[model samples]
Structure formats: structure tokens, C-alpha cells
Target: MEFGIFMPNSRNGYIMAEAAPQYDPTHKHLSDIVKAGEDNGFSFALTMSSFRGHGGSTQFWEGSLESMTTMAALAKDTTFMKLIGSVQLLLVHPALAARGAMTLQDISEGRFGLNLVPGGWHPGELESLGVWPGYDYNEYRWEYATEYAQVLTELWRDGVTNFQGKHFQYDDLQLGPLPEGGRVPIVAAGASDDAIKFCAQYADYNFRLAWGGIDALNDIMTKFNAAMEDAKRVVKPYVALGVILADSDREAEEKLQRYVDTADLEAIEYMYTGAVTDTAKGGTSEILASMDQKGAMQMSTDFLVGSPSSIAEQLDEWADLDVAGYMLVLDDYVPDIKRMGAEVFPKMKNFDQTKASVA
Candidate 1:
């Protein structure tokens, strides 16, 4: 198993709490964190795209660096660690995304990954920007994504495309200087049946968030595997984890409890409400499950809050799931990157053999 750092391109990182490390994002700070990850054994860097923030005193995600541009810039900063950027389908056109992928891959010297996002989990974000589809589009998430993927592949493979689909159309559009060799590896996320099938067909890696417990995670893995079996395709799986490192498990718990006690309910409510808005499977609605069971402010069981040994023990279980990589999200990135390097990773089971290379 390898590791990746989920760049805190968003304000305040992943945790939505006033008490969480509140500060403005900076390129210098972000660079320092991923550089530390490169020094460790992290294999990749990922940045998410966010258009709006949940309303609250903290203004969660109100300000964020654009994912594509951010990754392009980070490409210049890192020697290893593949970098991926997200493209929100509703906000970005397929042809444009295809070209952008080519540019980033070249700029990164072939260390670029593309993440396709089927937008609509946060309707308000799209609506605010006037890009929200004028019609109902959530139910057709995977279908729309399939077309988007087709467009991208055609453009990348042939350097031009003449296609017509329900959601998009291209009139023999041309994009020059295709990416070297072929298409960049793609990453996508979703837990719904549609999502699973789509990943099996198109994405190279599936980004997932699993909760409920060991049994539920097993169920999800079963379903995902079944989909891949039906499609006769193999797509790697990865997870996003919120990490809190401390000298002891008790210390970590104390820190977590403090944040939970002061969690920005107003902002959390917005996320919860949006997550529950659609009945679609494996979307943000999945977040609702963990919020209901573990507490809204904190993340799923994937949230690793403990000392190096304790975190390693927890990770050992996940590594058994055959996860391709673990995307680490930290409250404070730079310092935590250093501490994780010195303590936690050295003790992790499946990842111990990965210490030699940046990837």
C-alpha cells in the first residue's frame, strides 16, 4: 500500500469546526506539506475543487485554490508523487478538460492524474455559480460521466472528436499535441451502483469513503468487486482519511472531542442537508451515515486519531482490504507531515515496504 496527501486546497482542510486549525491557504504552506510527504513514502498528491463554502462562522470551503491550476503549479514543486486535479462535470466542459489534462501531464513531466467529479452533491455550489444544470441531473450522474469520459478518451486518443450525446456534443472538435503515449490515469468516486459500474468502465482508480464498520465496509467491497467482475475490468481503490497524531491515544481523543464539542453546527447542517437531498447511492449522502453514527463534525471510522502504534494498527486492518493507497488529510499539514514521517509510517504494516521510493 502507498500513501497520498489530500492537499488542503480548501480553507481549514477537511474538518468542519471553528476549533480546527483556522487559517488561510497559501501555496508556500501547501508546498511545504507535500514536499514533506515526498520525503516520506507518499505516492501522490490530490486536490479537490470547491466552488462554495457551507455558511457558518468558519465559512467552510468558501475560499479554495482551483484544483487543476493548483496541481499544475505543484507539479513544478515535486520531483515525485503523481499529482491529480478534479474537474467538476457541471462546471467544466469535456473538451476543455481533455486539453487541460494534456497540458498538466506535459507540465508535470508525465506525473499527472485526472479526477472526474460528477457534480450535484452540493447543488448550492453550482447554483451559486449559475452552472447548475437547468434540468434534473443528479439521477443521471454516471450516464453523464460516461459521456464525459468518452469525450476525453476520444480527444486524447485521436486528438479530435466528432461525438453526440445526451449531455454533450462535439462537432469534429480538434485538440492538438495529445498527451504523450496515451490518456492519463483517471480517478473517480462514488458508492452508488451506478458509480461502481462507471468506475469499472472508465476510471483507473476509484476514490471511496466507507463507514458503518467492518461489516459494512466488507459489503461495499463485495459490491464493488461484483461490479468489476460483471464489467471484466480492474480499477484500483483508494481512501481518504483524516489523521490526528499525538503522543498517546488519549491525547488524540481529547483533541478530537474538543473539536466535536465546538463543531460548526451551522456549516455541518448545510453539508448534512445537501448530503441528504438526494437518495442517489454513494454520493455525499454517504457522509450522512457516518454523521448519524459517529457524529457530524468528525469523519467516518477512517478518521485515525491515535499515536503512531495505534494508527498503524488501525491501518493494518484497512490494508487488508487491498486499498491501492491512503489519502491522508490532516488538520495541520506541514508539522503533521513531519510527525507522520518520523513516527507513524515507520510502524505501519503493509506500507513498511514502501519506504524506499517517493511513490
Candidate 2:
């Protein structure tokens, strides 16, 4: 399996807590993380496109960098690592997104990727930006996003699309100069069942959280593989994991406890509330509702905590699940990234950190 950082372009880096290192995302910090990933043989990095935050003490995700623009700059700066920028079809029209994605593809010389996102994880986030179609949109967003991808793909591949579909109608619209290779790799989170269907049809890569243990993951993969079978196309899966490392398991557990002890309850509640706002079943939102206190507040599951070897063992267990790679979410990015590269990388079993392409 390959590796990637779920780059912390959002504020505070997914740990909703007052005690966690609370800070705004910066260009230098984001660049440093991707650069570290490159030096360490990480194949790709993805930044979420979040326009707003769930407000509470830590102001979770309140301050954010626009993903596409940030990645365009990264495309120019980095030489090899694949940079996947996100676009919410509701916010940025596919015709327009085609332009931005095409530019980044040219800039990165074919190392750029595009990720389709919902209007926002929360409806209010898009509402605040004057783009929330409606709350009922959550139900049909899967279909809408599929159509959106169709248009974007057509425009990028053929340079013009007269495609007309339920949500979008592109009449002789054109975009140029086309992306290198005449296509851009697509990524998306296959959260709900419908979302998985969309992935089978459209995305080249799909991300699923490693929340449910192996059995649950196997079930998801079964469903995904079945859909792929029907669609006659394959979408490689990547699992996202949370990391908290130390010299020993005992120390790692203690640190995790401390973060839990000081967990930002109000912000956590806001996160939980917004997550469940979607009626879609079997997604991260539902997982949040089912979690007990620590599970919910700890943010994500499939944690790799302990010494580097211990973390490697955990990764091996996950690697057996057979994903395209793993996208790591580090509790502390800079130091954790360095430790992961220098220490843990060599310990993992059957993992490949080599890049096959650049420039």
C-alpha cells in the first residue's frame, strides 16, 4: 500500500478540543506537511474544502483555506507528490471547476487530482455562503454529484460538453487548455450507500474512514466491490486513520486520555449535531451518533498509537484490508510526520512508499 497525509489545511487539524494545538492553517505549515510526505515517499495528499466551521470553544474548522487555490499553489511548489483539491458542485459549477482543475493539472504536469464534495458536510455551511439548495438536498445529493462529475469529466476530456442532465445543463460550453493526459484523476468519500454508487460510476479513488472494525469494513468493501462489478469500473479504496504516537503504548494511551479529559464538549456537540443532520445511513455522521463519549469525542477510529513499531503492527492489520493506500491524520503534524517517516516507515509490512511519477 502507498501512503498520504489527509493534510491539515483546516484549523486545528480535526481534534475538536481546547487543549489540542489550536491554530489557523498556514501556507508554510501546509507546504511543510506535503513536502514531508514527498520526502517520505507519500504518493498523494488531499485537503478538504470547508467553507465554515462548527462553532464552539475551539471554533472547530472556523478558519480555513480555500482548497482549490491552496492546491494550485502547492502544485506549482511541489515537484512530485500528487495534490488533490476538492470542489463542492453546489458551490463551484462544474464548468468553472473544469477550468481550475485543468489549470492545476497543467501546473502540476499531470500530478493534480480532483475530489468531489457535498455542498458541505453541514447544510448550514453552504447556507451561510448563500448556496444551500435545501435541507432535502442531502437525500438526492448523490445523484446530483454523479451528474456533476459527468459534466466535469466530459469538459476535461473532450474540452467541450453539450451534456444535459437533471442538475446541470452545459450547452456547447468549452474549456481549455485541456489537462495533461486529457483527464484528471477523481477522488471522493464513499460515505453513504448512494455515495458508494457514485464512486463506482465516477471516482478513480474513494476514501472510507476506518471506524467500524475489520468486519464492518469488509461489509463496506463487499458492497463497494459489488457496485463496481455492476458499473463495470473499479474505484480504488483508501482508508483514513488517526495517529498518536509515543515511545511506548502506555505513554500513547496516557496522552490520548489527556486529550479526552480536556475534550471540547461544546464543539464536539456542534460537530455531532451537524454530522447527523444528513439522513444518509451508514456514514460517518451516523457513526458519530452511535459512539460513546470518548469514541465520539476522540474524533476518528482506526487509531495508530504507540511506538513506531506498534503503530506499524496496527497498520499491517489494516493493510490486510487491501486498500490503495492509507491517508494519515496526525494529532501533531510536523513532528508526527517526521517520526512516521524516519521511524515507523521501515517497520510496516508489505508497504510501498515509492513514487512512480514526477514532473
Candidate 3:
């Protein structure tokens, strides 16, 4: 399986204030994290895009860098790691987004990719753009995104697209200096049924939160595969988020709990309420409840927190479930990234071959 690092642009207060005393918005700090990942054999780094943050004690989003621009910055700075910008399609014109992607692809020498996020903040954010429409916004948003990507893909392939749809229309548009091989990989994330259908139809990768162990992943894979066949497309493997495997299972649990305990309750509360305003499923309690029942939040491994050997065993289990890659979360980016690269990756790369030889 491929390993990717999730570069945290913002952190909950409890985690930020407690875990690392030196949390700065300086270029040096961020560069260290990126350098660690690149040096460590991590293939990609994922960053989320958010336009505005709801303010107050419970900060909705405290500090987030713009996605595409950040990716461009990282691309120029880093050498080996593939940089992903999760673009909120509703907030961007496809033509502009495609241009940005092509530029980043050139900057990164074909190591740039995108993730499609159709749902976003509600009236507040939309009104900020003066583009707020009436109800049925969700339906319109998804349809617009689908058409937007359709046009973007066409243009990226160096084709003059005269695409017209109720939500989006492009007249004889061609994007030049196109992306490598006339394509850029796209991933999509959501738990809603509409989101799943969108991934099945358009994405080269389906990003999902790990749930209920391998069985749960298997079920999700089954659904995605079925959808792909129905849509006359080949389904790619699921790339999971929130996987923080360490040396051992016990260590993993301890680290997760530490964050939970240290995390600013007020900040988390704010995030929960903000979700409601964002038209997202609300509350940390509710989210955790769902995760508990479904075994979603924890790493789907008895080995992740333990030593490298233990984590490798758990990874093999996940590989059997068809997980293509991981977007790993960590308490401290630099330390964990170095550890993952220095200790874990070498073991994992050869683990399967050793097991095969044994069998």
C-alpha cells in the first residue's frame, strides 16, 4: 500500500497548545514537516481548502492556508512528494481551477493532483461571494461540480470543449500547456450517498474515513465497485483518512487519547456547532458516537500503535481489505513523519515479500 502524510495547516487548541509549544505559522516550521515527509519516502501530502473561518472561542477554522496556492508553494519548495490541493468546486470556476492545476503540475513536474469537495459552508460563505442562490443548493452544487469537472477534464486533455449543462456551460474552451499525459488524478471525499455516486462517476480515487475494520472497508469497496460498473467506469481503491498507525497498538491508543484529552473542549464544541451551520453533520459527541458504533475513528488495526513490526502486520491486514493508500494523521507532524520514514516504511516495503517467501 502507498503511504501519504496529511499536512496539518490548523490544529485544535488543545492539541496545539499542549502537544507542541512551538506552533508557529512560520515557513521554516512548515518546511520541516514537508522535508521530513519527502525525505522519508512518503508519496503524497493532502491539504484541505476552506475559504472562511467562523470566529469565536470555539473557532470554526482557526488557521488554514488557501489550498491551490499552498500546493503551488509546496511544489516549488519540495522536490519528491506529490502535493494535493482539495478544491471546493462550488467556490471555483472550473476553467480557473484547471489552469491552476496545469500550472502546479508544471511546477511539481507532474506531481500535482486534486480532490473534489462539492459541499461547503452555507449561506454565510456563499453570501461572502455574493453568489448565494435559493434552496436546493446541495443538488445544484453537486451538479455544477460534476459538469465543472467534465469540462476541466476535457480542457486538460487539450480538447476544445463546448460543453453545456444546466449548471455549467463552456463554449469552445481549450486549456493549453496541458497536464502530463493529458490527465490529473482526482479524489473525492464524503459520507453522503450523493458524494459516493459522484466519486464513482468521476474520481480516480475515493477518499473515505476508515470504519469497522477490514470488514467495513470491504463493504465500502463493494459499494464503490458496484457503482463504478454501473457508471461504466473502473473503480479505484479506497484511500482512507485518519489512520495514525505507530509502532504498536497500545501506543496508537495512547497517542489518540492524549489528543482527545488535551484537545480544547471549547474549540471542538465550536467545530461541532460550525458543522451545523456548514450544513454538515454536527457535534463532536455525535460524530464520536457514530464512530464508536461503527468503529470508525480508531485505526482499524490492533498493531498501529506498537512497534514497526506490529504496525506492519496490521497494514498487511488492511492491504488484504484493498486499501490503496493512507492519509495519515499524527500528533506532531515532524517527529512522526521522521519516525515513519526512518523506521516504518523500510519495514513495510519488504514485509509483503518476506511473508510471501515464508508462505
Candidate 4:
């Protein structure tokens, strides 16, 4: 399987605990992480787009770099490895998004992709910018996203677009120079059935939270594959996993306990309450409601924490489910990255370093 680092564009990375690595979301730090991934054998690096922060003592995700601009700078700095940046469809017009994507594609020499998010969960983020579609727009956000994707794809492939829809309109619009490959890959997360269908139809890959274990993951993949078959197309499946490694299993367990002990309960509560209240109709709200305190603190994903050998064994077990790859969420950016590259990567059964080098 392939591997990629979930670049920490936000403060405190993915972990919400105060004990986690506290660092500024600076360009130099991000660049260092990207370079480490390239030097290692990673296939890509993805950054999430966040317009606002979840408030608490830790100030989780309070400060973040804009995804597209950050990826553009990384594209100029790196020679290989795809750079995936996120965009919230509600915030930017599709035409402007397409033009920015085209520029990024050129900058990366066709090594750029997009992670599209249909905004609704964090309404305040868009509302502050005067772009939120209001309360009634929650249930139909995906429908709007479909139109948004259609406009973007048309502009990229046909170089001109003339269309009108309930959500967006374009009249004889043209964009160029077109992306080098004639198309840029799209990635998206699908928590509900309709969202899964949308990904099968439009996205090159489907990203899901690694909340459930192997059996749960298998069920998700089965549904995703069925959706693809129904659509007469195939889309790869990826999972987001947090990693915390140590010299031994005991040490790793201790560290995990510390993360939980100092957990940002207020921050976690805010996130959970917000999801259930603002996104009551969405599938993710159900998932959030089902999570326990620890699960919520870990962002409802499996934390692959153990010695190198144990982590490798867990990864091998996960790969057996035929996952396309993993987007690793690290606790500490630089040190953990170097250790993963030097230790854990060599033990992975599905990763071929030679093939990655040639690719």
C-alpha cells in the first residue's frame, strides 16, 4: 500500500492535548515535514483547510496555514511526491478555485491534487466570511458540491464552460492553460451513503476516518466498492490513522495514557456538541455521538502506538483489507517522521521502496 503524511497545517497537529508537540504552523516547519516525506518513501502529503479554530485551553487548530497557498510553495520546493490541498466549496467560487488549481498544477508540474470539502459542519467558519448558505442549506450541501465539482471539471477538461444549475452558474467561461495531465485527481471524505456515492462518481480516492477496527473498515470498503460498481467506475480507499511510536509497547502505552490524562476535555466536548447540534442530519453526527472520551480525544481514529515491530505488524494487518494507502497523523512532526522513515517503513510488507523511488 501507499503511505502519506497528513501535514500538520494546524497548531498542535492532530492531537488536541496540551502535552502534544506545541509548535507554530510556520512555512519552514511545513517544508521540513514535506522534505522528510520525500526523502522517506511517501507518495503524497495532504493538508486540511480550516478557516476557524476549535477553542479550548489548548487552542486546538486555532492557527492554520491556508492549504492551497502552502501546497504551492511546497510544489516549488520539492521535485516529486504529489501535493494535495483542500478547498471548501462554499467559501470560494468554482471558477476562481479552478484557476488557482490550474496554477498549482503548473507549479507542481502536474503533481498537485485537490481535497474537496462541502462546507456545513463548521458553519461559523463560513458565516464569518459571509458565505455560509444558512441553516436550510445543511441537508443539500452535497448537492451543491456536485454542481461545484461539475463546473471545476468542465473548466479543466473542456477549457470552457456554459452551464446553469440550482447552486452555481457559468456562461461561456474559459480557463487555461489547462492542467498538464488534462485532469487533476480529486479526493474527498464520505461519511454518509449519498456522500459515498458522490465520491464514487467524482473523486479519484475516498478518505474515511479510521474509527472502527478492521471489520468496520472492511464493511466501509464493501460499501464504497459497491458504490463504484453502481457508478461503473473505481475509486481507491484511504484511511486516516494517528501514530505514536516508542522504544517498547509499555513506553507507548504510557505516552498514550499521558495524552489522554491531559486531554482537552472542553475542546473535545465543544467538537462533539457542535457536530450533534449543527450537523444533526449528517452521518458524522452519529459517529461523533457514539464516541467515548478517549475516542473523541484521538479524533475517533485508531492510534497505531507501539514499538516499531508492533506498529509494522498492525499496518500489515490493515493492508490485508486492500486499502489503497494511509494518511498518517503524527504526534510530533520532525522526530516522528524521521523515526517512521528509518524504522517502521522498512518493515511494511506492501511498500516497495525501490518502486517508490522509480515512481
Q: Candidate 1, overall lDDT?
A: 0.81
| Candidate 4 per-residue lDDT over residues 1-359, each given as its tens digit | 77888888987877878777777699999999988888887778888899777778898888999999999999977888888999998887888889988999888888888889886666667877788768777678788888888998999999999979998777899998888767788888867877887897789888878877889888878777887888988788778888889999999989988888888888887777666654534366567667787787788888988988889889888888867889898887778778888998798886677654432
Which regions in candidate 3 have their CA more than 4 angstroms from the true location?
Answer: 11-26, 54-60, 121-135, 241-252, 274-304, 349-359
Give the alpha carbon lDDT tens digit for every residue of 4-104 in model 2.
Answer: 88887888887776767888999999988888777766778899888788777878888899899999888866888888899887889788888998888
Off by over 4 Å in 4: 278-282
Q: How much is the lDDT of residue 275 in candidate 4?
A: 68
Scored by lDDT, the top model is 4
Candidate ordering by lDDT (highest first): 4, 1, 2, 3
| Pairs in steric clash, model 2 | none
- Tell me the whole-model lDDT of each prediction, alpha carbons only: 0.81, 0.81, 0.62, 0.82
Question: Which residue pairs collide, candidate 4?
Answer: none
Model 2 C-alpha RMSD to native: 1.7
User: Where is model 2 poorest over a 10-residue stretch in terms of lDDT?
Assistant: 350-359
lDDT of 3 by residue, 1-359 (tens): 56676666643312322332324244566567778776776667777775555443335345666778878888877877778888767677788888888888888888888887775433455556666664456445667778878988888886568998887777788788878899888877755556667777778777665644567668867776777788887645545544445656777767666644544444333334433443334212234333221132132211145566666556666666655667676656777778766676666643332221110
TM-scores for all candidates?
A: 0.95, 0.95, 0.80, 0.96
* Candidate 1 C-alpha lDDT tens digits along 304-338: 78888898888778778756777888888888888
